[model samples]
Target: MSKKILISVVGPTAIGKTKLAIELANHFNAEIISADSRQFFKEMQIGTAAPNSQELASAPHHFIHHKSIHENYSVGDFEKEAIALLSHLFAKNDYVVMVGGSGLYSDVITKGLDKFPNVSPDIRKNLNEILKKEGIGPLQRQLKVLDEKSSNSIDLANPHRLIRALEVSIGSGKPYSSFLNKDKEKRPFKTITIGLQADRSIIYDRINKRVEIMIDKGMVEEAKKLYPHRILNALQTVGYKELFRYLDGEWDLEFAISEIKKNTRRFAKRQLTWYRKNQDIIWFDFNMSKADVFQKIDKEIITVQNE
Candidate 1:
């Protein structure tokens, strides 16, 4: 039998990846698996730019709002579940489309996660204490010194990610990034990555506009609903975090909105940094017509399957 194909739609946030994935899925009669970490939570639909009702109806989708914010979900858990879902999907369709801006989550499907040495629980406890007392600055600086690559690519604003990287680097006496992609498990399906990108200025402009749209669509209200649960890892993302600060009275709404746009731009840049290293993604300008992208993807699918 011919190898099945997994077509990944990846790029920075607000870049039309979901639209493209739906079109691809429709054309191929395939299903979509969302690798976006934020979209997993049911409460974060507006903030995460999750597919709307029409989009969900256009394609069969998995892993979108399938978990609650209160659940303790990890990348390892996602890997197990997604791999099993792929097995079921491949048995029915020749192509399966996975779409998301969360590069780490996407990588777990394409390249299996690397295992790191266990660190003492006290290390995490100390890091949490530092975060609570001094804020995320000290931990960020520590990761910057210990694993510069991870510091550059991962979400620096997330205290959980910072602590995880720092603990691994501190305990193993090796840069946390050094352990990544070291044991990529083979998958039965052939994988093809499609990246949508544009100039930095254009990307930033899109992010700004999207943030404004989200605010108009009641993202502030959504954030308010989730604010009581701000400590949840799911709420630590860009849009809600900024709104949480606004709700905290630390900054005015205007300033909070601006920070949301600014932080989202930074997140997009970090996403590009992570994906550029893969070298497998076939990139297209975000403005390219869907027809042209579909033509190119068809060629790539044929080429990948023949390899």
Candidate 2:
């Protein structure tokens, strides 16, 4: 049996993943499967940077604007859906690309996700109550004592993950880390990972500029439309969270903007930390010529094809 090639473009925020992925998809006769967790929601186009109309038309993309903030979606579902899509795409094309900065989403597509025993609904309900009453700080404290390893990898700002880990730790009588295994699962296709990076100042400047562009594109209205649903997990993202504060009059507009910049810089650092820990990725400077990046991609493809 022949195997199709999977090319994954990943890096910190504002590192040009979308444009590069689209161009690479066109070159490799591939389609793009977006691995960004936030970009999945149709309501979050501006903040999540869902592919513009031109990029969507450039090469077929999947998992972009496929869900609503009101609906529930998780990494396990993403892994299943992405594998199914990869199988279908492989039937038609020789290569497929999955692109995003979301580490968990990327892991789902490239590495088969480990399934954990389900926690009781009642436990989840109580956890929610605790989160509502005590706030995320208490939950973070519990996680530190119960499953510090999981806390290190998962999103600390997310109430859903924190509560879920607590419930699992109590119900299953095992550390949440035990549920996350390092054992790799075999897949039908081979995935080659690419990382994009830039000088620290340049990347930070790009992030600041991107946030400004989002505002110019009516990000305020976008967040306003979803403000009523602010409690949802999807709205907890950096841009939305900061804007939510502004809508609540917790801080003035200027302060909210400053918080967005600070939070985004932190998010970018976290993303780089995740990617840097993985030895499989080949890093490219973001300032490199388009041709140079393509040449590196071509070399990887040739290596995979020969293997």
TM-score of each: 0.95, 0.96
Cα RMSDs of all predictions?
A: 1.5, 1.5
Best by lDDT: 1
> Using alpha carbons, what is the TM-score of model 1?
0.95
Worst 10 residues of 2 by lDDT: 176-185
Report the lDDT tens digits of candidate 1 across residue range 1-307: 5779999999999999999999999999999999999999998999998999999999999999999999989999999999999999998988999999998899999888788898899998898899889999989988988889999778888887888899999989999999976867888888889999999999998999999998999999999999999987788889998899999999999999999999999899889888989888899999889899889888987787678
Least lDDT summed over 10 consecutive residues: which range in candidate 1? 180-189
Quote the lDDT for 155 in model 2: 75
Candidate 2 Cα deviation (angstroms), residue 265: 0.7
On residues 1-307, what C-alpha lDDT tens digit does candidate 2 reach at each position?
A: 4568899999989989998898888888888999999899999999887789988999998999999888889888888888998899999987899999899889877888876787788988887888778888988988888888988887788777677788999789888889776676789898889889998898899999998999889998999999999988888789998999999999888889888888899989889888887899988887767788788877877787788
